[model samples]
Target chain A: MAAGKRGNVYVVVGMAGAGKTSFLERVATYLERSGKPPYIINLDPAAMRLPYDANIDIRDTVDYKSVMSEYCLGPNGAILTSANLFATRFDKVVSICDLRAQDYEYFFIDTPGQIEIFTWSASGIMITDMLSAHFRTTILFILDTPQCQNPQIFMSNMLQAVSVLYRSRLAVILVFNKIDVASHAPLVKLLSDMSLFQSELEGVSDFSSTLTQSLHLILQEFYEHLKIVGVSAATGSGVEEVISVLEDVGAG
Target chain B: MNVFLSLRSTTNHGTVLSPRRAFAPTFSMPYAQLVVGPAGSGKSTYCHNVHQHCASLGRTLSVINLDPAADEFRYPVTADVRELISLEDVMEEEELGPNGALMFCMEYLEDNMDDWLAEQLEGYMEDDMVIFDCPGQLELYSHHSAFKSMTEKMTGWGWKMVCVYILDAQFISDGTKFIAGCLQAQSAMLHLALPHVNILSKVDMLQDKSVLEPYLCPDHQRLANELDERMDPKYRKLNHAIASVMEDFALISFAPLDISDEESLQFVLYQCDCAIGYGEDADVRTSRDVEYGDEPDMSNLSLE
Candidate 1:
């Protein structure tokens, strides 16, 4: 965010099965084809394999399974603990990224599969704060476009996004993934007008619909400041729009 | 003037002289269940099915709608909150959002318990059975004083109440989600401080019923082990802590409710009945013993 900084850090977070890693891989490939190769950091220790080779992989330093056995944690706990263990030595990682900042214009981070493990965990906060203090950082929250067609699921995702914004105090870009399966225009329309959401829930008598409608009204301010874009990881569509929006967000 | 007076007196006398049933339905002890849970957990469906089941058994139960935002009902509503105040009216008049409007509506209902709710409930006999369909918002039962005060006021009215907490079985497909649901139920229990019955609603939609068997009557050890296996080792203490707290309180077991099955609904109803000590105050008749003369002594009959 300063005049001297050359690289912008993007933290990709989303619910499991939301195609966060796939989106990151698409971004990496796009950046490479344009001759402006981005620095990719794989923070998810539990990832079996990645689509693109990460320059700095947490799995290289921390073995997720060994951490599980060593700490007597479950799979999720192991991932979180591995992230925590990796976060402690993050200063070294930051120094490396800083050294390469002169050459790299963009940095992409793939968080854990489970959204809360990265968004709600202390290690997540520490890593985010460290990166933001050193570079221009943004949270790329991926939403499953098809799954978000259900208003209940959509509201839950919005609440999660709002919580992340409040906690991190960082600029957020809501990336609706899986555009190949469904269009995000309806969701975009719902976000722009509160009355549409009310009418959408008009058929249901469940109090939850009312709750969701009320939540939409309460989230109007959050929606106003949010930067939204739709992309498909499988088809590599909407990449240009995402990159342009990222540039706009980075500049503003 | 005399003719007019005589005509009025004759009408009054005729009204007084008309044949009427002498016996008014006497109630035993009023029983009520406040159906509460998160959104889309099937609270209304539960109320509708339970009301129908009770009606088929020739039992009378009143269904009351307490959600001001509710637009429709499948069962015949005995008393509706929309009559007193609605979320729409509150939002339009007070210039409040939906959540704030809902809170205001509930608090308004709490304030009018003496005048409006009492009058609406005045027709019930002493032993009437009633089910209140409450809002699905978590805050109503968690920390809101409206529900707590309403409970206090209802108790003062000599009504035995049980909180029927519902959880969507489909949402709790994993070990961690199950633990989270238990914790939420326990939180509502601690907050309301009432006789609580947790129900796993919409069990008919579950893909495998056997997967939920262990959760119905949860084995503390097995639950903790499963929870530990699912969570990372760093949260091992937290997993164990939750399991132990659940076991100590003995309040986390859920009764499964399958609306399509009568037996399942009956079992769920039985649990709620047990929680409120329903049917414990009935007066048993011993008229047969009084009708028959005394027989031979029990000692002589045993010797033979």
Candidate 2:
């Protein structure tokens, strides 16, 4: 698309209500500040509202409501079906991105609310393959900062993040969202300090807590491979650090 | 839950459950609802709304928190699966993914239904309706046999079980999303093999409410026309194939829900009752209620 200047593709995925769309806008804001504005693609056909403008919107290509009624599918199934349908023509989407690849430094794509729907589905693979064909693709896995306080729940959510990391084998950037509401500093501390995690697990001898202890060990290695960023999409804080991390990735 | 194993619990259990002995035909039963949907589809909200609606109807419905992953609930839980086996415990004990751990939690519930759940359930009266606010994991209803087995167990315990599949109203305001919701409900119904009711939750959030009216009942013709309009001509076959299923299955109809509106909430309750024959046995209960009516007036005729 350009002489060594093609854009990077960012596939943003997360659990429902983890604020993926809002976070994408913040990333775009950070990218746009340096005049390398992102070319966005909104892959969630069922999303009711999006904060950012997308160069390619799935809603424009496939109407999820029509797919829902026509396919006699539920919201989950219709989203999947519409995704599959849109995925069939994803080569076209990639071609369009290639056409605009010169103007943008980043190609940001926001996935559906259901993380599994994007990460664990056939359509997810199709979309990823298309992006990786021309662009260096990375997954930004978002986690709700307020929701992951409990060691057990945190482990479960971490396992979820680890899933896409393992499945796609793409470089994953863990975005700890909603930091303005709940700071992730304690969580970052727990991940790094064993004694701190032990203290967090104090007074709990259940299987989950004990397993979370074991998982903390395994996650130590995983943490080595992945990158973590704490961002408040609401207040637009930490957006620069996220861009700096991506820039480092580009450099590496 | 271990609470059911206590001596105080066992003693009080008979007082509540014993009344069912006279009413159980061994087949007919008061209804218990199983709330299901994917994550963030408002299953919890629906459970909260239904609990309030039943409370207004002079019915004390027990809301059961079946999601081991759920941390908070709006209702006062009478029984909870989190007490028996939680995702936290499963994830700790078994090296499983979130979906796997959640599945383990549900299967664990199903395995203990006869003992743990039965004990907890027996403490409530036969007419104390139960609403199971299940996990958002779709596999539990799509293919997993745990819920199906639980349904069988509840049926054997003289409780009619129905699956309430909640879908976000915003998603279904359009055509493609409407089909997805139907297929999801159908998959759940097929797997659970229980009477199912589909709910379009959070209808008030939809910008143009009129867009959803067609999908509530889902007329085949209107849906196909809408599909044709929205989808590309090249994919007409795919669109028609999906629309045809809606016509044939007749299993995908949804009832719109506006949680804040009393009438709307009650309407959904009415649909659920019709699906499960809830209080259809009212004639029997009412007839029994009128027993002492003209008998004491025997001074006029019965004594002769």
Candidate 3:
């Protein structure tokens, strides 16, 4: 969209243990094989070990463990502080990418395990905003398919996704990860057919369901705007669809 | 002394003549319960059920919808925040997202409290037990100062408030989620600084109700042990620290709410009553006194 902006940036964000890194690794391997290896940026300070080699890693700049001990903060606080520390110097990161912009067509950012640490924190928003200003950015919200089979859990994830979308105001692609374990089709079907979700909620017959039932009506507009792609990082399945969807988003 | 009155019909707003007459002097201050939780935690439904339960017993109660994002209501709202401002309208006009629009709507409501919320609250009796069904956004109660300031203003207006923190029973099925829920509830408690009651809402959805026993009155040590077994060894210190925090305060026990069972609902409401000292000043009554006139003695009153 802008002159001199050379690559499309995909920010991978999701709840803890949502297989963000696994999916990223899978996608990176695929891209590497396809002769278009994407530049990877690992932003998760608390990440124990990344499966893919990152071109730029926050952990290289900020020691999360030391930040925790020095500040007398817990794990979450340490991660937030570390992210904040990285966000302050994010301009350098943008410049570094800008220098190498001609070498790569795509940039993938791996966020922290704690979704809120990246999504809710001021530093996280600043970093996201900075990236969007520099590149064609899209959020890849990885959802744990098995965990979301439950209607209540599904609604919770939907709410969080909506919050993240509105907060960032970025184009988001709901990448339903771990479809190898649980198919995302049923969940997608539930979205399309209101009665199916209602009937599933009928078994519960509680007040929460009633509220969720009402929320379904409100979230319809949100769902209509969303682009969903089911992928199994374990099996390297359905990633092409994600790439295609990202391409479409980038083109538009 | 507490002066209990009959609930006016939802359609009988015009029939209420001097609603606050019997409540103002005797009670000196009214009472309120703020029902709040994350999205889909059954706040409005709790308010609806509690309202129905109280009305059945001929008690006067008012339910207020404080969520601007709320689009439906099962209970008749005495005062709705949507009336003054709505999330949809704010999002459309201000070009704000749902969360931002909600925050904007809340602040907008706060700015116009005297002209809006205060006036809407005036129609109800002073001592009528009011339930404010708040928005589902966790930030609003956990750390947001908007709700805190609003509640303080209401307190200044002579309304004793209790915070009803609801979590779905699904949370109890997992140890970590339950801990997260507890921490969220505690954060709200510290922020709101009100008499707090934690409700495990939608317990009826659980196939085995006994699964909730341990969670109801949590044993911090056992919780730690279970959490230790479930979580990775690396998180042991964190788990222990969390458990100790909960144990130190010991203010986070949950009341499992089964709305279908009248006894369960009463128990939950009774806890709220205790928190607010609802009937502490009420006149002593004999067994023969019928709380609701002409109502059948369906309840087996065991005279002490």
Candidate 4:
């Protein structure tokens, strides 16, 4: 497939088990069938198994098992060590992507499952910087939908989303995942109707009622303009809507 | 002639070979102490509790009060940043209100890292542990560069710190809420990039542990299904992705800690200990000098 004139790169990021890989697989299938499959790169070092074929895999370059065996590390240590190693040799990863240059419509980087490796580590930042330098990357933030049903959890997730936006400096597309099993009405109601959470927001802190109120008001202002889509990767429901949004962003 | 030549060569030739020995393991204490969590998550309380716990154990630990708006603490502090940058002062001087002032205080602290934090931590021993009672602001751990910069500076000072993230157990009862808590915990973990331990604090406050039991030892697939069942149908796809990611990555399980329970506290502490490789240097000793007497006669064992 020839590269689309838009030439967009989307990075799907979330905590481990956030369904990033599954979504990528489905998206790849969808795009492949549509004759525009994305160039997918798997960056997780500690992944013992995966469901999809990665165009580029970090494991091939850095042997996580050898690092564990040679260094006497547990799983987390090995993952961190492998991430550090990738950071040291990220140029090779860039070259791998470059090899597939203009071969696909988009480059979808499947990040490390550990959120910390992508968000907090210097290596994560370096990867983002390198990707941004090469292509216009937008972050597809997959949020657990059930977690957002409650006001407090929603607030915390919002904080995390904001954090990632600031840290990665990528245009964020927030996707509430796992909606097939949960009551999306309450969350959709919460996001759609901001007035319902006024008292709840006020109740979080006494010192910042005015501050909180103003912040809430500001959030509502932005919320009205924001595009939030809920989807189920398992059933393929709402996947098209998500793709449309991605396409729009890519075009933009 | 060949025998004479071999004997002469053997007598004149010599080889020097050095045998290789196994390298000894090296251990060094952490240089930094990181207290992290959301606002009102009992970060300060945990710091104080840890201080008291260390004292009771006859261990020397110092507390650094990093919260500029902090009014009181249960532990004695060796150094405080309020003296350097007060939230009230930031608000009054810069005309910024509470949130802005808190950010200002953090930025101010960041600006003076060398003079303020370095000076405070200067006299401490290499192995000395300090508890940094941080502010309650969520952004400090989320996106701000101030905390990251501080961590870098601490690491530069030879501190091998672990970010102790405390979430209230009472709040994390349901699968959905637990997932949310895990994301926040994950955020802090990601933002800090240091060794991290996710603690479900205030376990003592829960009258019944049944609600939190599953979350303590979370099954990702089960939680994902529960989460899907609870969310609105419109977000089913989103819920699935969230569940799948969680199930796929195993990103968000927590070690529950009831500070009031010694065993719970000890378990959490043990996790932290392993994170920093704490007891790696201790000498191993075996006791084999005990002698036991055969006791077939009348029992002489005294009940004291």
- How does the DockQ of candidate 2 come out? 0.03
Computed on C-alphas against the true complex, the DockQ of each candidate is 0.03, 0.03, 0.03, 0.03
- Range of the 10 consecutive residues with the lowest summed lDDT in candidate 4 chain B: B15-24
Tens-place lDDT per residue, model 2, B1-304, is 2322332343454433444443344334457889988666788888888787767655668888888877777888887888898776786789654455677777788777767787677644445578899877665675456887788766655567788888777766467556545655654664566888888887888778878767766788878777667644543554565566557546568877777777667667776777777765454553332222222331221111
Cα deviation at B80, candidate 2, in Å, is: 0.7
Compared with the true structure, what per-residue lDDT tens digits does model 1 show for residues B1-304? 3333432353353322112111233324478999998655789999999999878765678999999877779999999999999877887899754455778888899888767776676556554689999976665675566888787766655568999999888756656667756655654664566799999988888778777777877888898788667644544554555566567657588888888878677777777877887755432433221111222232221111
Cα lDDT of candidate 2 equals 0.71
Among all windows of 10 consecutive residues in model 3 chain A, the one with the lowest summed lDDT is A204-213
* Candidate 4 iRMSD, 1 decimal: 15.6
TM-score of 3: 0.53
Native contacts matched by each model: 0.00, 0.00, 0.00, 0.03
Worst 10 residues of 2 chain B by lDDT: B295-304
Task: Order the candidate numbers by TM-score, best to worst.
Answer: 3, 2, 1, 4
TM-score of chain B of 3: 0.84
Which residue segments of model 3 deviate by more than 4 Å? A1-252, B1-27, B123-126, B283-304
lDDT of each: 0.75, 0.71, 0.75, 0.65
- What TM value does model 1 have? 0.51
Q: Per-residue lDDT for B56-143 in model 3, tens only?
A: 8767789988888676689998888988998768878997544457778888987887567767766454446889998766656744
